[model samples]
Target: MNWRPGCDLAVLHLRARLMRALRAFMDQRNILEVETPLLIRAANYDLNVQNILCQDESTDPRPLALHSSPELFMKRLLAAGTGPIWQLCKVFRKGEQGSYHNPEFTMLEWYRPGMDVQG
Candidate 1:
């Protein structure tokens, strides 16, 4: 059986459980959910990320890059005094396609002040 149709339901169930758990986990510690821009003038140049490209209405040759990660902008927020923030967003990358991989994928990222990746 094709699994694509079931993906939506699976996503809902998983997202619900994950979101519920995370919200409680973060709430207990005073973190906030946040939204970030989906487009960017430039993207993370990390060698690991191959960017998926898009064009704008102005037809700018340097079309806005789909955000690879909101990490950079989110850092700016942290610097500007926003408390801990978490986000779930769709980010794009080029040249990846598989049963478990897509050219674009959902990413869950969160940041807490005074906590490192080890935390």
Candidate 2:
């Protein structure tokens, strides 16, 4: 059996460069980069999205759900007076299988306070 990574080194390097560029762009706009929990006590209530439950004996007995998005946590930060913020994190979704859709994927989410459609 052949053993090799799906992504090549060149692709990895390009991805890293792209991420760096994104961070730089956000920083230039005075947007803070933040990180939130991947596993949360509660899952998203969106009916269209399915949350993946984590079962760990060593941790709390209560089920932990993998966050489908950082929107909730980021909103909390916004309520706490945090200005524009952005996050690059891994999100999980269950019952999704396809070439374009993945069970787990990296997502870039951001929140800009006081900005609306007509801003």
Candidate 3:
């Protein structure tokens, strides 16, 4: 059982610095940081995305899927009149493994109520 970290201390420090900078940038724009559930009842049905299913059937009769993106839940918040919001969370996808792609990754998503594509 290998217990060492996947990356070195310098990499960890760099990640921490990046996260701080991102948070600072968002704070300056008044974007609230929010957290949503990782496991949800419905899976994303996007053509190229596959969801990872939870194995613990004993907990719930219906299967739960690890969210590939926080879009759905974030949209719900937006519909409920929550102002501009941003989220930094972990997302999971099934059967994705490569040098540049992993089964799990951190995702940063944001929604501004009145912003359009051009903006």
Q: Candidate 3 residues 1-119, lDDT tens each?
A: 88998899999999999999999999999999999998888746666899998867777788888999999889999999889999999999999999989999999999988889875
Q: Candidate 2 lDDT, tens digit per residue, 28-58?
A: 9999999998888874667889999988869
Say which prediction, candidate 2 or candidate 3, comes out ahead on TM-score.
2
* Over 4 Å off, model 1: 1-11, 59-61
Give the candidate number with the greatest TM-score: 2
Q: CA shift at 90, candidate 1, in angstroms?
A: 1.4
Better of 2 and 3 by lDDT: 3
> TM-scores of all models?
0.78, 0.91, 0.90
TM-score between model 2 and native: 0.91
Tally clashing residue pairs in candidate 3. Answer: 0
Which is better, 1 or 2, measured by lDDT?
A: 2
Could you tell me which residue pairs clash in candidate 2?
none
Global lDDT for candidate 1?
0.82
